[model samples]
Target: MTATLPRVDTAPAAAVKRRRRSLGWVAVVPLLAFTAVAFGLPAWAVLDGAFTDKGTGAYTTANLTASLQGAYLTALVGSVKLSAVSAALATLLGLPLAQAVVTSRHRALREAVLTASGVLANFGGVPLAFAFVATLGNAGVLTRHLDLTDKGWDLYSFWGLVVVYLYFLIPLMVLTITPALEGLRVQWREAAQNNGATTAQYWLHVALPVLLPTLLGGFVLLFGSAFAAYATAAAIVGSSVPLITLQIADALSGNVLVGQENVALALSLDMVLVAGLVMAVYLPLQRRSARWLA
Candidate 1:
């Protein structure tokens, strides 16, 4: 009664590992170059310009100081308010939509919604603003037919801008939250059911807790998206809305307020700070969600 031990080959695996390690830089170099050219240079330019004087190129804090005052300050506040409202609305609406898509029995419906979301999420800027204006603006098709203007529906105002933002923000939220929703395991539901938990109880206690981190992360993501939206808002409302992006454009192009390149860069610096804060919150939340989801 003898037992035999099987032999395993190591040379092929070792050679493959060595080959992969050697070839790894093939991908790394291009990515590094792209990052340097695309992100690094732009970031350096902003940092350099933010403190430098437009006339002498000498270092000063006047631009940054000016950016935090008067109309520029108002623009910053308006931008934050808009971003928060849009992101909040998007997160609330998109969660249920994502849930519906996830829980649906029909594969075709799920596929269609997901496909539509992917397209619509990235479908912002001029064309989208134009479409909305054509459909809802004064003298627009819907406006002419329904007389929405008389009924106090102004499509070029603040609330109107929020509505337009919702168009893309909701879709972006759907795409962002869908994966997190899918990460909700069936076994967890079954376990809760076995413990005599109702559907509501199961969700409220188990599901919501697990999904909270993801929800927060998604909110942060949506916030960043809405905060950075410039072209769409510009096309629809222009300088009518007191948004930081518009303010920056105005200053850079010498349209109004503080018309200076350094001031524009300083405003951009403020934007970078806001984005940094968002990333700071988002990264931790993502890590937490990953642990639970995994």
Candidate 2:
């Protein structure tokens, strides 16, 4: 302070920050553009069509009314039921499988499991349906050998669909929950035991609380996966099983009734809303899970 210190300038630093921020936005422009073109436009078309009559280019709510009634309503309910059952089963079965893989002593076995899970998770749609059919369909090899029909097991039935769904669903859950399972700290278990907690008690109290959010998140994802499924169900059970996606396809393809394209859009809108609701619930849980797991 003895001499007049050289005047400090904050202007240049502020300017540099502004420039960097602008550049950051510029870098993200392409991604934003892509999303707008790819997703936003299609979503807008569905939403717009849902409120507009197909024959008359006029706005109306008739499509939604028609979609929420009769067979459409049944399909919606069936889709929800299927998704809930499959997601729940997958979560129940996959949690232990994921835990096993994560806790395995052999690194090779872990790698193999994770690799197989990745393959299986993406191995759904038509091919997966065919694989299940070959293994369990009416004229399937297993069906011929075991005579499952006599036991009242039908591969084209609801329970059969659930079983086929689990083939991919379990693997998806395994892939998703494995990282969360790995996040579980050994020290926490040791500490719980030090405090006189038994193995079951530690897991029931500490481990479960930490893992609940992640498990719920996984369930939501699986539910959405099952809800949106079309090809696999189409290939295996066709229109026999009342599912939203199959109905939507029927509407869009004019297989149900002509001039119901707007109804298809309405169904799509309903699906979007349902999926949005699921994500709305999932986001908070996922954030909470991250706080502990991170």
Candidate 3:
């Protein structure tokens, strides 16, 4: 027993292990700290502020109730309507574009179109708004050239906002749906055609059933983007037309209804609600996609 194990020591080995653990922590700590400071902290602050007291010492639903009022409700409806219509139109226009991109025999043309979509899709907000304004605004050169003098159109209206939303939404739809279309078996279309099926019949029976999930998913994405838009609408119309983003901006800036924290809380709740609705559409779409593959 006295001579057991030659009196071997594990202390140095344990020390080396401890050093490695410490080095791991050194790497992990920075990322954890950044996440807590940047993302987690602000999200917590905003969410906590939503249920907090405005001026009174008591916490209440006053802000939440205020958000459900007629004006916000109207604005919410308008936002949804515009986003839905624009996304629908964009998808309709984008399907063919995607098909062309995916099936093109010309490598150069396909590459160019994909490049164009990527550029346009990312070019939302101020640049897009300004571009449309230059083409369609009341004092725009294009408008003047078309002999539409004194018959100026407002690009600051609800419909005008829809048009701007479409410019970006179409490209997004194309980028998303093209992959789904490509994944589809080309033989299915050829088989139907060999059977003398019309284009309409082939689409309805063979293509649409498989494509519905992807199309719906694309729609949800488009709707979310449009609903969350602030910059384009803000830059184009300012406060002339009531929009949810402008309202939120005003509240956050404390520029309107001074010191009224309840309004901000209410608007925050409204955004949450809209976001929830958008996510609701997402679940069914995912399920449908699974079913399509099954």
Candidate 4:
């Protein structure tokens, strides 16, 4: 005795598909409009200006060439190095903390930790700078309490800048890495242990491969943040450090730099360089991410 075949219901399925397709545009249109206005226009302006000669309709490389001066080059190099180092430090510091939080049984504690991290991550610019200054500056609490003439701690130095940068970077790393670590499967660890794999071997073979892409992506984002950082460095060091952002601001003010037009051109060139670097990293990362998802 053969079983009867199940009835097919194509009409309802098609109707549901059509309904979803119809409603999709309602969400799509507004998002498209907002993106075009807010992001598209500004990006177009920047790109256009990068290629165009302000004085002449014909294009010129003079602006770009001039921006590649020793001082500007040094600033760019310093910024990239600082960002990379800071992000690396954050990753090293945050990874274990993320693993601990994800493996924790205490839900309340996890939430509390995450909340605190979120607050700190959002605390950039003047407030964060001021906080660091208050803690470690000349008249700061730490300075007043601990006096050591031999071991000098200056917030104006490159290392001091990095310290402040790490304060912000660490929180960002915690926020980014927590989700990636949480996504890791638990059985893998037990399975590795069963196979006589050491903790380092297990992580090196399994966990690290999965985590690397996300870590790299997070690092790029952190680098962008550090590179674009203006307020924090400005507030703490008061243009004494002479970062790219501070230089740009000075140029924009039209009072400090020798030539206002040249300064503007230089800033535009810096903007282009930053944009190019971001795109260079982001495009490959996006493709790599897609492969991981697949």
Candidate 5:
């Protein structure tokens, strides 16, 4: 009770906040710089080159118009169809696999499945193409043994590309949807059962609604992955399949046509636009999923 206490200082709190803010900026600096150097610069270049004449340095829409005509249009359609089919198949196959992994009793089995999925999801490009070729191509070991050619199997065709795509796509979906599957609460199922709801009814009325957003998001991701794929298709089938990515490469290298570098940029821009539209749909679904899962 005795004396005048020294005035408590409040400046320390402000100083701490300032230090934290500085640290936050410091942490983000590298990321910002990397983005500017890598993604931002390249994206800007593509946008610029797409809208400008290379020789005349004049603004034009000719390149974009050219991208939408003839074989380029066919390539776009083929790419979209391929991506859609692969994403759909991967979603259909992966949902069951993810459910099984989530519901498994053994921890080791769950861990192993998840580990394999993580590795396989990233295991694309040349090596993956080569593996498929060795296993299923015309002169492949399995091909010779199984006589798949006579049975109407071709590893260098559109369906064959679909088959190859599913190898990585399914694992990606598994990795993506497993968390959503795990987010399913036991209490929900228990409550449904207690209320005399059949398993089918529970899934149809309750679980599907909860999982729908995440499922769509996963599908969109898989579609984008398939749409942008290049190396694997290039290695496996060359230019046999007229995919948009292959067309873009062709335009860039002046292989199919000269003086079409701007058209290549235009195609790249189209890809970006498509990807943007996909993300626009996916973002809302992702947020909705988080509302339930979180």
Candidate 6:
């Protein structure tokens, strides 16, 4: 027994395993640290400030209550309305465009469209607002040439803002839906054809059913993007558009109300709630979509 024990030394192997485990934990530390600093800390600040009264430093629900009343409520409604409209239009427009690109005979065309979508999807805020304003503003070249002002084309109005939003939202939808479209297995279509299903029948029965979740997910994604937009709307419509984001900025800057910074935080909290609801719906649909697309 003593000779057997002497021959079975495993200390070095155990030490190596322990060292690898330590390294694994060490690798994870930086990421955890970054998350805490970037998201966790800022979130805590918002929550704390949202609940506290600036004057007495006492926690209260008045700010939250106030966010749901009067102009604040209107702003929230406006934001929701704009986001829904833009997302719906973008989904309708982009799905077919993406389908066309995906089914295109020319590989170069597909590549060009996809490349353009990737770039345009990310192109927004000040520069985009500037471009639209220059091209569609009251004295803009197109506005002057086409007499769009006479046709009721006000670039700073609700419909105009919707049009501006669509510029980026459409590209975003194209980028999002293309992958799901590509994941449509060829065998499924062939199987449907062998069963004597026409193109419309195949899509109505099979393709649309499989893609419904992905479509809904894309809509939610676009909705969130439009809802959170600040800079572009700020640059274009300014206070003319009463978005929740604009309300938040106003509160923070005392542009509309002084000593209302906590109320702004509360509005931000409301936004967080809305975003949470969006994520709640989107995540489940996205997971279902992944099961099919994978």
Query: Cα lDDT of all candidates, in order?
Result: 0.94, 0.94, 0.80, 0.76, 0.95, 0.96
* Cα shift from native, residue 264, model 3 (Å): 1.9
Q: How accurate is candidate 6 locally (lDDT)?
A: 0.96
TM-score of each: 0.90, 0.97, 0.82, 0.82, 0.94, 0.94
Deviating ranges (above 4 Å) for candidate 4 = 1-27, 51-58, 258-269, 272-276, 279-294
TM-score of 4: 0.82
Error of 1 at 164 (Å): 0.5
* Model 6 stretches astray by more than 4 angstroms: 1-19
Q: Pick the candidate with the highest TM-score.
A: 2
Q: What is the C-alpha RMSD of each candidate to the true structure, in Å?
A: 3.8, 1.2, 5.9, 4.3, 2.1, 2.8
Which candidate has the highest lDDT of all?
Answer: 6
What TM-score does model 1 achieve against the real structure? Answer: 0.90
Clashes of each: 0, 0, 0, 0, 0, 0
| 67: Cα error in model 3, Å | 0.8
Superposed model 1: Cα runs more than 4 Å off: 1-27, 257-259
- Of 1 and 2, the candidate ahead on lDDT is 2
lDDT of 5 by residue, 128-167 (tens): 9999999999999999999999999999999999999999
| Clashing residue pairs found in predicted model 5 | none
User: Which should have the higher TM-score, number 1 or number 6?
Assistant: 6
Hey, what RMSD does candidate 5 come out at?
2.1
Query: Where does the lowest 10-residue lDDT sum fall in candidate 4?
Result: 257-266
TM-score of 3: 0.82
lDDT of each residue in 220-255, candidate 2, tens digit only: 999999998889999999988899999998998899
How much lDDT does candidate 3 score? 0.80
